[model samples]
Target chain A: MAAISLRRARTIIRKTLEKGQEMGLKPLSVIVLDEGGHVIAFERSDGASPGRFAIAQGKAYGAVMLGMAGTAQMQRAEAQAYFIAAAGAALGGQMVPVPGGILVRDAKGRVLGAVGVTGDTSDNDAAAGRAGIEALGLVAEV
Target chain B: MAAISLRRARTIIRKTLEKGQEMGLKPLSVIVLDEGGHVIAFERSDGASPGRFAIAQGKAYGAVMLGMAGTAQMQRAEAQAYFIAAAGAALGGQMVPVPGGILVRDAKGRVLGAVGVTGDTSDNDAAAGRAGIEALGLVAEV
Candidate 1:
């Protein structure tokens, strides 16, 4: 089983923030969670709202727990609100059904970890996260 | 990265309970949080309900995390119910949108911490929290 290293997580966070800056997006909060949905690294940019931590962690947790990207969870949230709501409860409110959560995969398509970003439009957040993972030569399963 | 000192947090809790007693309010639970939203001090007056701690901490956490007083969060909760709900979920239910939470600030208006009081009416609870901060010569951004 592949795992995300702490060094890699730091790089991902740095790249994610850099991407957000380059895109002129709002200050971002980013989190990297290992395949088991445990946080490996997290950071909130200056001026970012404090709620970003919870939102970012929740997004990554949801993606890792559900074995899919946050985009899919968001679609499921629309189509199955009751189910998603129940799932959120079942996850102890640690799952956020939204974009900006992307699964990271190794070369053989094995899940490595996930990246979650917040503090901007969901699409922009997702793009930034993807840029971070791709920069590390890892696949971003968005 | 301004923070609330332990001594100041203790003073705020004492003053908050004192104000509650002066007003003949019910036994109150008070909590102070540092700028990072971590609890700095907490006190529960005798006869206060067991649930008061959670409510008080929730209020204080909400204020600190949102960088505003609970009054503002309460208003936003009404105008943006969905957003508030999502945020609450993201916070793992640690945020309670109510009036008893007040932000503590320094002379220059930088946030230092937050105080939360619960027991009496929301307005009275807020007043007690305000008194606590003011007693310590700090600004209460209520």
Candidate 2:
């Protein structure tokens, strides 16, 4: 499996922010995490709330940990609210069942990492995250 | 970036407890955090519950992490419950959205640190935090 480099992580953040700006979305916070659920890079746009860091990180962390997109987690959360809540507790609050987390995958469909975005609508956040991963010539497993 | 010194952190804790006593408030727990959200000083008055430590730390941690006073966080928590809940989880349960956290600032309006007080009523906790910062001749952004 390929790994996300620091340079690539930074690029992902930049591209995510750029997409948010082009779409005239709210100021965003973005985070890239390696497959092990470690943060590679994170940035919060000016005027974004402080909680953006945790929210974005949680989204990506959840994706990486569960091996699924945040949208799937959202469905799981709805279908199994108690289970998801327990999992969130077990993960020490690292899982966020939201729509802004996207898994990064290599061309061979191996997991690379994840990108999470916040500070706008969840749908818009996911779109921006997808744009970021695609801009880096990687697959965004949304 | 400016940092909060140990001497000042201790002073803030002392003054906070003093203000609580002067106000005839209940036993209080106070904590001071550096700009990086690390604890600098902590004190719990006699009869304060053991949980006061986590509660106080959570308040200060949230303020430092978010670049806002605990009062502001309280409002934000009300307006954005889901986002705040996710952020709290991402923080590993280190954030408590309440009114006891106060941001310490320099004369030029740069964040220096934060103080959190608990055990008393939330309003009184905030008042004590403000008094502590003011007693240290620093600005309290509440």
Candidate 3:
């Protein structure tokens, strides 16, 4: 898989936060992780809760690590917390099954990384995450 | 700015442990995370309890995530435990809003990483974290 450039990661974060601000969301945290599940960039908007990044990282990590978007993983996790937790424990406790985590795919449909957003309602957060990926003309896995 | 070097991270860990030992504290574990809040290095002194690394990394991750020291995060977390817990639930349980987490900033004032020390008094742990950052002439964001 191709690597996601730091520039692209920064752009994703910048645009996501911008969208959050424009939407008048309370506050937001965003994180970008590479295909290998390593953090590429992270940011928490002013007034965001201290725990926002952890949640954001979890969402993104889950999306990448499970090869599925966090929105779906959240459903699975909710239904089977014990099983999910057991599986997530292996990933340095960074799995977050939530709606705000989305995968970023290149034109060739190869996943390059993931973007996670948190703060507002889950649906809004997911929208912002998807918007960020689309801003760069990249695909956000459905 | 370049990524934080593992050598520097190890130095921070060594100095942190030295401080813990000088205070005659219990076995300690330390974690160093890069700018992206990724663990760059970690160590658990002899006799340290299991799960020390998780606790140490959680503290550091909390500090970096909120752009505040874990000491302060712990304070806020106490007042809003419910909110923080709910938010943290998404991150696979890596958020620890407690003392002993300190930010590491380069001479340029850029966040380089964070140092988290665990297995000692909160105040003592925080002090050791600061000591480790100071040893490298790096600013520990108060």
Candidate 4:
């Protein structure tokens, strides 16, 4: 398992936010973490709502923590409020398994960190997040 | 006024986490907010208990929203837990005014944003945040 460098994750977020702006989406928040689910960087755009970064961070961490994209994870959890609350609590409210996450992979397809975004509609949020990953010249296979 | 770009904010977080790991501190939760009190990015390290992001973001937002640092905002708002909680809730749990945020600034003494860290003693969180800002060629002026 090759460790993802902090520099790489940082570059992904920087370029993604820049790309998101070019796409004309609402300013979004992006979070990247190493394979171990630790935060690498979190970025929100100016004029974005406050604390939006937390949602992005939580979604990224949740994806990495669960070894799946947040979109799928939410499906697995379904409408079980108790389960959802428990999951959120287990992650200290950062396990936001929403629709805006994509797992980053190395050339060998090894799972690296995950990138999550929030602040736009679910589709747009996912688009921004996916765009962030793709802009880094990496494939999410999302 | 120059905004805190996602590129720069992510750099600070990654650098700070790397430094904290070297120091053997607990995995920390870091929060960054633009000068307008909007989140730019954040991270919650693995093994970092949940809930830190909320507190950290709240502190960062409160700092900028109040036109003061987290500590000073807490000093003024300490007498009003209800008010603080209400504010935090009103902002969807993103308003934290704890003791871990610093006013991010450029060399010209212009304010850019605020960075806050958690998952340790408040003082330690503040120190880690400061370390990241300094690493980014900027100052975390209190």
Candidate 5:
């Protein structure tokens, strides 16, 4: 249960955004959350939407808070804005739903932390984030 | 010059929220912008609508871009969407039409940064944002 390091977060962002570039996606914003789902770092690429950072942070926070991938949480949150709203209120307004993030885990499946990205389609964003994490030879449990 | 760091952005957020408390305003989302009007730090206080962060940032960015407060920009933009939209497009959508933000200047009237706040009515939000900048001993040149 080690705390997520800034180095890991930076690695995740650089790797994931590198993938995004390969895919010809727009600029991206990446947010890294510690095991407790607190933001450790956030970076917005030039030309990313103003919503990029907030959405990215939200996805990462949700991935950790729900102990699942952000895609699942997005489905649930879309159908139940009230629930998500309640969750955000419950979590000090740290939870957001937009897409492009996932939870990282070790071989033993201990939650390492979460990385969220935004600036393209939600699906693409999530894939890029996952690819970023995978590039580091880490697995995304969610 | 170095772009504003996340640490300085955090300072803007913390100090703005503190000013909000002193003003008896609701929880606010605060934004700080660099000379180029990029978002430096962003935070939404407990209970602030998720929309507030975007709005606040836009307000601050818009203030810097228009060389006036957001309230003034809104009116000007109503008359000229192209002016607003062109600038916003150039900025990748960081400018918003809402109010409740101001530019911060040093005692000698040098532009330092911009702060935008939102949580209550746009007017109230701008007032709160103004209070935050004022508390920092910074004045608005416009």
Candidate 6:
């Protein structure tokens, strides 16, 4: 499995914050997780709440575990609320089906990991995550 | 600025268990977290309790966040229960004061990350953690 390099993960986070600044959005918490849904890098920008880190991490974990973009995963969670709830109980309470989660793919379309952003509107967060992936010259599975 | 490699984290977990076997301890759950206190790798050996992951993660997070080994942190928590409780409430209840967490350090003694082990006596767990770090030729700041 080709993992996301720490250098690349840092770049993704930096670009994500830059995008947020460009859009005049709130300070964001960004997390980059490995393909196994473990965090590789994380940053909570100034003015972002500490809670944002947990939310960002959960979003990234869910995105990678579900192998889908945040919006789609959230839609599924909404539609299958009971199932998601039950499944979350089994997964040690780490699932988050929010709009900030986006999958990162290499040039060959292989999933490398997922990046998630929080501390803004869900749509804006998702957009920032996608922007980060694009900024890395990688494909976004959003 | 060096990040804990996934391969090294895996090795830490494996060697930790090997130490457990040598010491005749029960199956264990181990977690490795980045300096940012985010889970970078984890494992639950066979026969380990299902809840070990959560416990392991909490110990690792507490150790890294406090910049002290789990045993010392747990001791401080015991002596200053009110402070730990107040802080935990402020941090969204993610704090755990246990004896299975240890910090990982580079050869230069810079804090790199933390390792947490569960499912054994706290002393044994801490010992296994130190062994794992030593096996990797890394400093265990316990």
Candidate whose TM-score is highest: 2
Question: How would you encode candidate 3's per-residue C-alpha lDDT over A6-124 as one tens digit per residue?
Answer: 99899999898888888888688999999988999999887664567778887788789888897677667667666666656666667766688899899998889899888887779
**lDDT per residue (tens digit) for residues A1-142 in model 4:** 3655545666677676666777877877777777777666666676677767667777787787778787787776786657766877887777887788778887778888888877777667777667667765677733
What does DockQ come to for candidate 6? 0.06
Each candidate: what lDDT? 0.86, 0.86, 0.79, 0.74, 0.72, 0.79
Error of 6 at A9 (Å): 0.4
Tell me the tens digit of each residue's lDDT in model 2 across A1-142: 3799999999899999999999999899999999899988999898675567888888999889989888888787667777777777787888777889999999988899899998777899999989999998999976
Best by DockQ: 1
RMSD of each: 4.2, 4.1, 8.5, 6.3, 10.6, 9.2
DockQ of 5: 0.05
- How high is each candidate's TM-score? 0.72, 0.75, 0.55, 0.60, 0.53, 0.56
Worst 10-residue stretch by lDDT in candidate 2 chain A? A46-55
Report the C-alpha lDDT of model 4 over B1-142, residue by residue, as the tens digit: 4777766876888787887887778888787788777766777776666466667777787677666776765766678778877776776766667668678888998888888888777777777788899987897854
lDDT (10s digit) by residue, model 2, range B42-125: 998999888899999999888888676888878867864554666677877888888998889888877787888999889999
Q: Give the clashing pairs for model 5.
A: A69-A142, A100-A126, B100-B126
Q: In candidate 3, which residue ranges exceed 4 Å CA deviation?
A: A1-142
lDDT of 1 by residue, A32-97 (tens): 999899989999998876678888988888888889798888788667777877777778887766
Q: What total of clashing residue pairs does each candidate reach?
A: 0, 0, 1, 10, 3, 0
CAPRI accuracy category, model 5: incorrect
> Any idea what lDDT model 4 has?
0.74
Q: What is the DockQ of candidate 3?
A: 0.17
Query: Can you list the residue pairs that collide in candidate 1?
Result: none
